[model samples]
Target chain A: MRLIGKEEIENIAIGAALLGTGGGGDPYIGKLMAIQAVEENGPIRLLSLDEVPDDALIVPSAMMGAPTVMVEKIPSGHEALAAFKSLKDFLGQEIYATMPIEAGGVNSLLPLALAAQIGLPVIDADGMGRAFPELQMVTFYLEGASATPMVLSDEKGNSLLLNTIDSVWAERIARSVTVEMGGSVMNAIYPMEGHFVKKASIKNILTLEEEIGRTVREAMKQNINPIEDVLELVGGTALFEGKVTDINRRTEGGFAKGTATIDGLNKNKGSDCRLHFQNEHLLCEVDGKVRCVTPDLIAVVDSETGMPITTEGLRYGARCTVIGIPCDEKWRTEKGIATAGPRYFGYDTDFTPIEQLNAKAGITK
Target chain B: MRLIGKEEIENIAIGAALLGTGGGGDPYIGKLMAIQAVEENGPIRLLSLDEVPDDALIVPSAMMGAPTVMVEKIPSGHEALAAFKSLKDFLGQEIYATMPIEAGGVNSLLPLALAAQIGLPVIDADGMGRAFPELQMVTFYLEGASATPMVLSDEKGNSLLLNTIDSVWAERIARSVTVEMGGSVMNAIYPMEGHFVKKASIKNILTLEEEIGRTVREAMKQNINPIEDVLELVGGTALFEGKVTDINRRTEGGFAKGTATIDGLNKNKGSDCRLHFQNEHLLCEVDGKVRCVTPDLIAVVDSETGMPITTEGLRYGARCTVIGIPCDEKWRTEKGIATAGPRYFGYDTDFTPIEQLNAKAGITK
Candidate 1:
């Protein structure tokens, strides 16, 4: 695990902030909490999933419910630990490690805090590689992991443990609890052996987030395009340099789902591209052929500054560039597409590599 | 396994249809398809979970996607079988049994059809024991079951196998498939052994559905109160009969969520009750106490004919009666309340058993 000091929290938060694109909620809270956790318990140990023992207990921790409600209903903070502890008590075992559920936004920084404070090393990998609504939306769920025997805690310190028959019911019940708890709370779930984590997670995402954060900031200081820096770090590349022209949004299906329209700027003009999002950019199509889709990273950023724009933050008239970065080799597989591709996001297109999409468009590498 | 024939399907559909309470979508298509499947194969065998061996393969058959979409893009009637076949081929094993994911509307009957045609027995239980849209909302999801390795078949003859890392990802990918397939498709998921089915499922739901269906139908013909008959089926009672005075609806989070204002009838006249829905009747707050919630079946039916008024169908000035039935006892546990109680649904009230709630109101069974 790479060692990071006190200042890294702010740096990572800023990097996460940039990648957040506009939503992902204020990274400040996660930053503060993480920093505190780190300060209290020393630096978080960030290990690649590959470093994890196959039989080690690994749990993903995060906040579930309306993010809008999260600000108002301050979490018990202990909810994650409480839930984690309860599960441990139930299983009569101790947790060996922790991991983030999503690698972007508040979630990205949260586990750093959890790991530092709880004295458990956090895996650098994540489930979706991005934020998504619903507790069961993790990659682990698709692989048959349980979100049940989960612990839910409110700000007032009320805690409940559930052992449901399925993840969806966990979501439904948890959603109801979130609403009742005033819309946001803390949760720890998807407890499984480290082997599952290694198999499912995009390994070393925490370090990647830190590097992504550090790279963007360092590049900014050196006047390098942070987008390119991010692309390079994550094996990604720029898809298009453009100005955000229009944004349409509605909170639907438990997510802020919307479309961001971008007008080509550098070489092309009057041509438009559409980016569809559901808490995460699922599909990005330019002039109607799929340009990029998951399990590749499609990040919209500032065309001028190379700052990231989150799924919920796409706005009309914001100058931006869309970048396509490759996910791990696994996401490009048939299993990957079946789980996180364009078709998975409702696009009629087949899964195409971002590089291929760029090549098809005659864009120079 | 108990044998249910053609007449039983007709009878059960009518009863389950009534119990569906509008949000379950119409049972007409499900009944027709199920009847055809049963006719083509044979009467479906109904079995208790205990009737099967521990190793007996039990998979749940369901319709995935929006109810509105289901009506338009009717299954090619091949999707379920195709999905089942995919799983069977993937595992190189034959399935021994089948079950429904829920016991409401089309869900209750569709599995019977699948089971009959596939020459498998239908377990008289389901994960949810009620209709909910998303795949992860099932109790089985909580039981550490994965929806992936599950099969999804579209009308276009595309049978996709998803072996995701988690259940939530299953929904995301499946949802995208549904949208790409033009929304609505059949799926077979939550593959498990019979032992898990017995432990998790609400036992005898098929017979219960049949009885619930029959009780309401016979009540209508016998000139008895259909609402009363429904209440009797689950040891429930009438909360209040009323006229809907107002309805406010908007689709949020991919769900039809809204509120209905009912003018209390008879003894409670001049007072009003508010019913909230998100795909289904989630709660009923009369004169401001959170009266009923999810897990407890709250159905708003026509006063005279006893037809359920669904969330999407609630209209101003509609005459109706609101009935509250205790959900499957599984829902009453702490895990259940945490998963589906009023508090879970965003209400501040503590859970009160329906009978107790009735008794408090001075209403007798």
Candidate 2:
């Protein structure tokens, strides 16, 4: 186990935003919340997957709702504590630790803040190595971990404990309820034993986020571009370098759904890339050719600073570099593809690995 | 306590439909479900408010969704049992008896059916003596009874336990979740102790329903018109005798919302009446003037047989009689009016007692 202090939170926030793939929520708010929590409660303890016992119960905590709504209605911190306590009370078991359901801006750091405040260790793992919009788009879900008994607590002291038949139903009901509960709520979900955690979770996600954050920060300090290091760290391909030309966004059904159009620069000058997203970037196309799709991670970072930009942060005329990382092997399975593949999101394209698409296009570093 | 048999089930269904105020659900379905349960489980024991101990827990069970949806998707008896059992498990206390949250076609009978299945007693009390649309539109809410910790269960083995700061939030969240759960789900809501039940509930609502049912049945058997007797029984007014000329309805936001226009017949031949509803009839206007408004109950029944017709059952060219009943004294309070009056339902008229409106129009038995 290692201690997650202010520096780790800062780095994790930056890395989480990078992996968040233009969704999750703003890292700035999560960063401030985590910093304040650490200042008041000291460093948070983070346990690796192997450190937890097989019988120990682990619950992942995060915020669920449209990132746009989250921007206006920041959580009051009490919500997370209430959700965890409610779930713990319902299970009648002591939670060994808390973790992130997905690695995203607010989601990844919220657990650290919660762990610090409640004096519990955070598992250095997450259900998704990168953010996905729906609840079932997690590696744990692909590995058959139940997404309930999940507790959702709003800022106004209302809470719901949902026990659904499947993760899909959980997503449907919880998403609608989230929209009703002022468009956002804190969730304590996917309670699993440590053994299941080891089996289902994407291990060392927090550590990876920290490493990405540190890489970006250090590279910036030395006045060098960090895009190559960031891409290499995630085993990702620099898909396109561009200036954002247009964006179409709408907050619907508790999700920030939209697309960003990027005008390619330098090597990709003739090709314009379109990034489609429902909260997180789900698809990427270069000049009308599929480059990357969901079950793959797509991130947009400042070309110079290499700091990640969320979907909400995308602006006209902003110079950015887009990267695509292969998802965890679990998501490549047939069931995972069926669960969150292009078809599920109403895309016409079939599942194809990002590297294969890049190789076909003869685009290499 | 009294034993409720199949005969009582039949009678309660008729009365529940009447008190449902042209909303709730169809009585025929609830009648069949309750009768079947009685055949299998013998009889359901119904306890009076006086019989319940002060500390005894009393949960009210009902179905939430548009009546139109309920007509198509009948709940399997398992949903109510699941909801009650889930709530019982959550509270960790043996629920003494179950009651109805509102007196409606399906809601009033659902508790009886559940009681029989679980071998739990039924309480003769209900939160609303007559049904209203929203969850918070109950006398219990005015008395400050919480609408949760409540459980909602769908036929597909999914359940949610909600705890809200107030009844309004409970209605908001539960309504959205109900829509997500296939537009209709069984709810175990407004859990209260016996003392609070007595204080908050409209007492002996089931008993009154049975009496209304018996009066109508006996009158029908003797070939006497049941309209006058029904009105006298409930201290209600015969507001209009008419034929349904038009109905404008759309099921939206988990509610059957619309208005029915009736062309007056007999003494009211020259006038036209408009009946407005959101699940339950909230307003009635005769010749473009407000006649009866909610928290008062407005019900439409067959002019020949006096059988109540649900909002969904309202049809064009059907000869009908519209009656208005004075609400419980508790509902005449300021808080009650603000919670469920005509204004609350978006009608411009102020809440006037049905008796006052009847006197003003010179409509008397």
Candidate 3:
């Protein structure tokens, strides 16, 4: 186990937001909460998935609802711990550690914050290597893990324990409750034994976040191209360097869905790129040719600062660098493609590896 | 304790529908479920509140959501029991009996159905003497009862247990969940001791329902005026006898709200009455004069059959009789009026007793 202090939280938040791929919710508030928790309860221990005992009980946590709402109605900071305790009590067993449901945005910090507050260790792995909109989109779910016996808590000391037959139903029910609990809530779900956790989780995501975050920060400090550093660290390729020209967004069935157009700049000056998103950036097209789709990371970052821009924060006129990175090998499996591929988002295309797409376009470094 | 059999469910359903005042949802499905449960598990016992032991644990049950949705998605007949078992496990205490959260429509029969299925007795009382749209509008809430530690369950074996600061928050949170859970679910709430149950509940509402239902059914069979029999049985007065000339309705924020205009006929010809409602009928104005408002009962029944007409079922050109009955004395208390009076429903007027309004209008019989 490695000790995680306040400084590391900033790095993780930055890196997680990058992996968030324009969804996951903003990380500033969650970062502050984690900082406070660590200050009060001392540093948290970060444990590798392999280090956990085979019988150790693991609980993954996240914040569920509209990201826009979270920005306005700040959490009470106690909801996560409340949900954790409620679930622990329900199980009548001691939880060995806490883990992130997804390695993206604010949720990446929630489990860390909860672990610090409760004096527990956070697992180094996560359910999703990158963010997906729904609860059932996690690798744990695809690997046959159930999200039942979930606990949901709100700011006003209100908590609900949910049990569903499947993870999809868990998402559907918890989502409804989240909307009712004033549009946002903290949830503890996917309780599992260490054996299952080791098999289902995306290993070493915490380390990857730290590496990505540190690389970007150092590049920014040195006045180097932060985008180039991020691309090198994540083995990504710059898909488009442009200024956002237009954005059209609407919330349907509790999801923010939209399309954004970006006018290419500098070397690729006359071309245009478009992004289609449902919560997370799902598809990226350059001059009407699809370059990347879901299950492959499509990140839009600030041109200068290299900070990830959430879908809710996307605005016209912002200069951005869009990058495409290959997802973990686990997500390339047939089951994984079927779970979160282009077709799942209602597009008529199959999963195409980002590397192949980038090489075919002959725009390599 | 008194035994309740399948035969009595019809009478209670009829009377409870009248009490629903246009909302609480249709009672036909709930009544059928109750009949099936009784046939399968034998007759259920109905206990007087006074007879309950001081420490007896009583849990009230009800169905919450849009009445329109309930019609399309029939229940799986196991949600209420699922919620009950979940809550029971959480409380870690033996539940003594079941009771209705309200004496309106389907909710009135839920406790009976639950009791029959579980072979437990049902209390002969309810939280609301007549239906009100919100969970916090119950007499129990006005009497200082908390709706926390509540359990909500859907037909898919999904359950949620909520703990909130007060009943209002519980309602707000539960209503949101209801919408998410396909617009309706069963809830078991306000688990109180026997002593509190007796003080908070509208006593003997089950008996009242049976009496009102039997009176109406018998009058129809005997070729007597069913409307007159209903008014006499409930000590109500004829507010208006008319043909439904116009009906306008809309659902807002999950509640069915609307207005109906009736043209007076026969002895009451040459005048019109208008009823404004939110879930339950909240106000009635006859000949441009306010005659009855919330904290009183406003019921619309078929002119010929004396069958209660729900707000969702109100159609233009239907011949109807409108009646206003005095609410239970408990509802006239300052706290009760403040909880569900005219002003509570956004009306500008203070609550005026139905009897006084009838007297002023010179329509006493």
Best by DockQ: 2
TM-score of chain B of each: 0.91, 0.95, 0.96
Chain A TM-score per model, please list them: 0.88, 0.96, 0.96
lDDT of 1: 0.72
Residue A223 of model 1 has an lDDT of: 84
Clashes of 1: 51
lDDT score at residue B103, model 1, on the 0-100 scale: 60
What digit string (tens of lDDT, one per residue) describes model 1 on residues B1-365? 67988878877776665556556677777788788887888787888777888888888888876778777776656677777886786566789888888766678888888777767888878787676666776777766677766776677665555545567666765666556555677787888887787787777777877887676677777877777667667666567778888988998766788889998776653378888887778787878766666777787778987766677667888888887877777767776677566666566777787767666666666
lDDT of each: 0.72, 0.88, 0.85
lDDT of 2 at A146: 88
lDDT of candidate 2 at residue B3, scale 0 to 100? 95
Per-residue alpha-carbon lDDT of candidate 1 for residues A248-328, written as tens digits (9 for 90 to 100):
888876678788888888655226788888777778887777878766767777775666676655677788888776666
lDDT preference between candidates 1 and 3, better one: 3
Docking class of 1: incorrect
TM-score of chain B of 1: 0.91
Deviation (Å) of B46 in candidate 2: 1.9
